[model samples]
Target: MVTVNEAKQLIIANTQLLEKQKCALDEALGRVLAEDVIAPISLPPFRQSSMDGYAIIHTDITQKGTPLTISGESKAGQADLPELKPGSTIRIFTGAPVPVGATAVVMQENTARENGTLTINEYPIPDGKNIRRVGQQIREGAVALGAGSLVSPGAIGFLKGMNMNEVIVHRKPKIGLLVTGDELLKAGDALVPGKIYESNSAMLAAALTNAGASEIEVKYAADDFAATAEALAALIRDNDVVLASGGISVGDYDFVGTALESLGAETIFYKVRQKPGKPLLFGKKDGKLIFALPGNPASSLVCYYEYVLPALRRMTGWSDPFLRALQLPVRYGYSFDGERDEFLKAKIEGSEVVQLDGQESFVIGSFAVADALIYLPVHQNKIEAGELVEVHLLPV
Candidate 1:
């Protein structure tokens, strides 16, 4: 068995980045940019009015209460703008282009206009007031967003404002999920003695989707050696990454390890020194990655978060793919002396983290309400109340 850090390092060292693809802005949310996006043109494109006011040369407002003739009106989106004659102003609305000779704008609220004449009630209007110069937000040919940046909703709007229809981003991974167990039955099926409803498939699928995976195919296989091998082979052949839930432990019916060996898969690491998911296995065949998780639902989910999720993010060209970590105080005292590191389901209450009940590998009730995982190293046995502990915040 490998240490948790060693396991994580091996997975990352073995993972390779996927190919880049051009993605339309409409469908690029949550994708990592493969290249920097440059602004094609300056934002605003021209000097623009930031308020509904009058555009005039600063010298025209010689003193307080100075009156100037309102030469013409300039509404937003107007292509033809009236020239501002000497000692005169133009009634301009927000986002309208400033006239050629105008150097300042006084908001309408600070001025009074009637009968084609405008008076400034406030004195000494600052030069270039309420005017957004060309390239105020971004200049042409400047980098809008650097590579490795995650495209967010706001980024989409920003890129659209830059007149970009598509962006170059790393392609999402295609995953093949295989669930193995003879005693497992699908939901809504009548369960016989010693049989239970299988839920790991649906649970892991949702988790994968949350991590930005879109192309996922699921398969079921019985515990028999041949059937398991056949199903595993097919999954490896069809997908870039394969995830097998169950049949990796030392039990008599476990066949995932043997199947992988027979198929010439290289075992990068077999197990990790961690609670809830000690039987996790990682390997590679050809250029495809594979992960075999423990049969218990909670163990499988924990392994996915700690190991598989990071690998997927790395493959998609993310620079920082690990879970968000923080040091938080514990709400209550807890004690445990185990041979391996423990990850307990927890929820943050105000400034402290509270460990939830039912943390067994087979129980997932507490995990349902958990928003973080409190990490407990192998050497530590007890935590007093109000003590600091490392916590990893879940993506949700």
Candidate 2:
């Protein structure tokens, strides 16, 4: 069995970066940029007004309530701006182009306009106030966003403002998920003998989706050697990464690991020195990556966060893909039972953390309310009330 760090390195070392693809701005959310996005034209391409008021030269407002004749009106989306003649001002709405020789916009509330006259009530309106200067937001040919940046919702609107319709980004991965077991049944199915409702498939699928894999294909195998082998082979050939939940341990029905080896995949690592998910299996073909996690729902999710998540990030060209982890003091003491390091489900409140109940691999009841996972090393038998421990924060 490999250590957790060694296991993670093995998975990352075998991952190959996927090729970049062009996508519309609407589809670019949560994707990493593959190239720099250069602005074709400056944002607010022309000097524009930011307020609905009178545009005037700053020096023209010499005293309080100084009157100036309104020359014309400039509304948003107008083709031409009426220029401000000497001793005159133009009424401009928000987002309207600022006329030539206009220095500021005195908000209508600050000015009293009757007939064609305007005045400044707000004393000493600063130069460039209420006006968005040309190229002020973004300059033409400037790097609007650098390569490797994550495209967020704000980025979409910003890119649109920069006149970009399409962008080159590391494409979201396509995943193939195989749920294996003969004793598993769907939620609505009847439970007979030792059969139980399947939950790992849903858990794994949700995790992969949260990790930004949009194209997911899920299937089930009945622990039969032929069925497991056929499903594993197809998944390996059809997806960027394959996540198989169950059948990885050394049981008579455990066929996932054997199926992977029979498919000519190079096994990177098998088990890890960790609790909850000790039967993890990682293998790779020439370029495709496969991870076979334990059958238990909680165990599968723990492995997904610790191992599968980083692999997805590496494939999609992320600089850092691991979960945000930090150390905090424990609020309760615990007795250790196993030699393997354990990732105990817990909640963090203020500066302290408390381990939750139901930490058994099959019990996911406590996991629902958990915000983080506390890491307890192998040799540490007890946790003092105020001892610091590392925590892996879950995605909110």
Candidate 3:
């Protein structure tokens, strides 16, 4: 048995980043950049007006209620008609390029119009006011984004603005999932005496997808040695990572761990010092990765977040490796074994993580209402209500 932190370190050290490929901006979402992106042109491209008003020289507005002649009207994307003289102003709309020799803008509400001329109001005019300068947000030829940065909506927009249509990014990894049990049945099947619906497969698949996997293949292996071995072999051959649920504990039907060992896989870790998910197995064979999680629903989710997610991130080439969780104060108190770590299902309420009642390993309803996983470390008996604990936030 090993601790979760030790297992995670081994997994990250073993996995390498996937190959990089040139992809269009639309397909780069959720991908990590493999190359630095430099800005080809300045953002905004030119000095422009920030309001729907008039562009004028600040020196012309020395007296209150002074009137200035209107020279021309300029709207966004329109050509700058002419330069404004000392006593002349140009009618300008929002985002219009500031005309030559103009350094300030006055909103229409602050000025009154009469006889095709505008008069200044009570506000004092300042030079270069309400004008956005070129390259104010991003300068030309500067590194806008560094390598290994995750691409999001803001990143996509920034890349496009910088004329970066294609980018080099790490390829998403492929995953295989296997659910094993003799007493498990798929949905729409008749429930036999000791059978329950198979749910871990679908849940694990969804989680892998959310973690940015390129492809996911799911299968069911009955509680037979040969059948489980066959499924495992196929998965190892087809995917970069394999996630198997159940058949790893010390039971008659627990053949997943034994099968991998028989196949000459170096079992890096067998069990973790954690509750609700002690039967977690991690190993490698032929340069491919595998994870065996307990069949219990809550345990499976906890293991996925703690062990599997970090491995996925490593495979995808994320350089700054760290798990994201909401560190909040506990809302409820409970006691646990002093030698094992525990993850309790909790809901975030008014900045406090309220632990859900009846959080057994098999219960799914509490898992559904849970927004985070509150972790209690080993050697701790109970967490007080106000103690700050690390929380692994879940997708809503």
Candidate 4:
């Protein structure tokens, strides 16, 4: 067995980042940028009106309630607009390019139009009122997004406005999922006396997808050694990472360790000094990562968030891979005699952390409402209420 920190270090040290790929803006959300996105042109491309008003030279309006002839109209999306005639105003709409020689846009609310004539009810105060100057948002050929940035909705909109159709981003990893157990039954299947519904793959898949992985192939393996070994070898060859749940402990059907050895994979560690997932196993073969996780659903999830998740982020070139950790006071005291570090499913209730009632690995009721994981060290057993503890915030 290894300490939690040592296992985490080993897992991250062996991860290899995937290559970059060009993808359309529509498909770039939530992926990491592999290259800097440079603005091809100025954001607005031209000086634009920020209001549905009239464009005129500031000097053209000498006093309040001034009237000028309406010579032309400039609507958004119109090209090659004629210049604003001297001593006259041009009707303009929001997002419309400012006509040449125009110094300010008078808000329509302050202007009245009648008989092809315009009157400024109130004098505009500023020279560039209600107008967006050229290159106001970004300069031409400027860096719109730096490399290693997480592609978000705002990023997509910004890139689109910058006329970027596609961007280079780190590719999502291809994963192979294998579950081993003879007593497992699929959902909607008839229940048997000695069988339980298979849920680890579904939960793991959902978690992986939420973490930005898209190409996940799920499979099942029986308890037999031949079947388990064949499936493990196949997944290792076909995917960047292979995740197997169950068949790792000392039992008649536990074949994951033996299977990994048969496939020529070197085990970096077989267990961790942590609750819920002490039997977690990590291996590497020809640069491919293999995680043989424990059978319990909670155990698998805990291992995923603590170890496997960081590896996935590393493979995708994320600058920070770990969950958000914070120091918070607890709502109540806690006492434990275990030697392994325990992760308690908990939530933040205002100023303090409250550990959920059901902490057992097989019981997931509390996990449904958990927003954070309360980390309690093995050496320290008793912590009084309001004492500070480290909390790992889950991704919302």
Candidate 5:
């Protein structure tokens, strides 16, 4: 068995960033950019009004009681006709360009209009206030976004403002999922004695999808070696990574590890020094990565966080491939007669994380409301109610 850190290194070492492709801006969310994006033009492109009010030269308005003649109207998308003269103001709508020689805007709410004239209700106004200047948000020729960063909705909008309709990003990985167990039944199937519903495939698939793997094929293998081998063989073709859950223990029908060896898989590591999920297998066959994970729900999830997520991020060219782990104070008292590194399902209570009750590795209910997991190291026995503990946050 290897330490978790060592196993993580082994898993990440094999990932190669995938090929890049140009995709439409709409489809770029969650994808890591493969190239730097430079702004072609300044954001806003022109000087524009920020309020639905009157635009006037500061010197044109004398006092709160004075009224100015309405010279013209400037609506959004309309060209500026001429400069504003002294003692004159233009009726301007929000987003309309400030007329030339205009230095200030008085919002319509503060200005009372009588016929074509305007009376200011507020006394003094500052020059050049409330205007979103040209290039204020982003300048032309500036590096708008860096490579290896995931594209978000805000990034898409910013790129669109810069007239970028397409971007180059790393292609999402193609994943294959396999589950092994004779005591597992598919949904809608009649429940047999000693049988449980198959859940690893669903959980693993969701995790892979959220990690940015766009394609996934799911399959299941029975306990028998031939059945397991046949199932894995049919699913592994052209896959970037294959994840097989269950059938990795010492039992006779724990066939995944042996069956994979028969298919020529080179094992990376067989186990880690972690509780609930110690039996994990990382390997490669025909240039495709394979993960033989433990069947327990919590174990599978912990393994996914520690190993699989980093690999997927690396394959997608993420600059920071590892998700951030936070160290939060424990709000609930607990004790561990530590023999292995244990991950306990937990929820955040303010800045502190409270470990949930009945956090057995196979129970899924405790994990559903858990927003994080607290790791307890070996050789430790007790944790106080207020002690700081490291927590791996679940993706929301």
Candidate 6:
């Protein structure tokens, strides 16, 4: 067995970054950028009007009620605009390019137009009041987005505005999931004695998808050693990472460890000093990662979040690839006497975190509503209300 920090360090040290790939900007959402994106052209390439107003020379309007001739109208996307005549104003719409020599724009609400004559209603029209200068948002040949940035919906739109059709990003990892158990039955099947509904496959699959994994293949195997070994070998051969959800413990039916050993896998760590997922096993074979998780549903999911998820993110080139951590106060007092570090399901209520019920490795009721995990160290046995504790915020 190894300490939690030691296990994490080993996983990080052995994990390698995947190769980069070109992805269309439309399909780059949730992907990490492998290179910086430079602006091809300046935003609002020309001086633009920010409001539906009249563009005029500041010197032409000196006081309130000053009248000037209306030359022409300039709408958005219009080219070959009429020239600004001396002592004259031109009607400009929002996003329309302002004509040369126009230094200020007076909003329509602050001006009165009678026939072709425009009168300023508000006095002292300032220069550059409503004009968006050239390159005000971004200049051409400038870095728009830096490398290692996560491409979001807003980022797509921004890149599109810069006329980018594609971006280079770290490719998502291909995963293979193997679920092992003989006493589990698929949902909607007839209930039989000594058998329960199988849920680890569906649960872990959903979690993997939520973490941005796209290429995934799920397979099932019985408790028999031959079947388990065959499934593990196939998954390792086909995917960059393989996750086996059961058969890692010391039970008589467990065969994952022996199967891995038969394949000559390098066991990085077999167990950790943590509650709910102490039997977690991490190993590598032929440059592929393999994790043998605990049989219990809650235990498997916890191991996925704490260990497997970080490895996947790191492989995909994320800079900080762990669950977000914070220090928060507990809503109520609690006590525990255990040598293992405990991760209790919790929900953030206002300013404090409240520990929920049903923390057993086999039960997931509390996990359903949990948005955070309150981590209690082995050295700390008791906590008082309003005491500070370490909290790991879940991605959900």
- Highest-lDDT candidate: 1
**Location of the lowest summed lDDT over 10 successive residues in candidate 5:** 57-66
The TM-scores, one per candidate, come to 0.97, 0.91, 0.94, 0.90, 0.91, 0.96
lDDT tens digits by residue: candidate 3, 254-332: 9999889777778888899888899999999989899999989888988898888888887776885555677798877
lDDT of 2 by residue, 86-130 (tens): 789998999998899899998888888888787778778789999
Candidate order by decreasing lDDT: 1, 6, 4, 2, 3, 5
Give every collision pair in model 6.
Answer: none
On the 0 to 100 scale, the lDDT of residue 301 in model 4 is 88
Each candidate's root-mean-square deviation in Å?
Answer: 1.3, 2.4, 1.8, 2.5, 2.4, 1.6
- Highest-TM-score candidate: 1
lDDT of 6 by residue, 1-396 (tens): 998889889999999989999999988888888888899999969999999999999888778999999999999999988778779999999999999889989999999989899998777878898999999998999998888888889999888987899998888888999999999999899999999999999989899999999988999999989999999999999999999999999999999999999999999999999998999999999999999999898899889998999999898777888899999999989888778888888999999999998989999878899999888888766999999999999887
Candidate 6's displacement at residue 296, Å, is 0.9
lDDT of 4 by residue, 1-396 (tens): 998889989998899889888988898888888898888999788989999999998887878989899989999999989988788999999999999989999989998889998998876557888889888999987888998899999999998887788999777888999999999999899999999999999999999999988899888999999999999988998899999999999998899999999889999999999998999999999889999999988888899999999999989878888988999999999988878888999999998899999899887778889999998888766899999999999977
Q: What's the C-alpha lDDT at position 145 in model 6?
A: 88
Across 61-178, the per-residue lDDT of candidate 5 in tens digits comes to: 6688668889999999898467888888889888888888888888988988888888877667888866778888888998899897779999998898777999998888889888
Clashes of each: 0, 0, 0, 0, 0, 0
In terms of lDDT, which candidate is stronger, 2 or 4? 4
Clashing residue pairs, candidate 1?
none
Off by over 4 Å in 4: 61-67, 112-124, 349-352, 379-381
What do the candidate models score in CA lDDT, each in turn?
Answer: 0.93, 0.88, 0.86, 0.90, 0.85, 0.91
lDDT of 1 at 243: 99
Off by over 4 Å in 3: 122-124, 320-322
The TM-score obtained by model 5 is 0.91
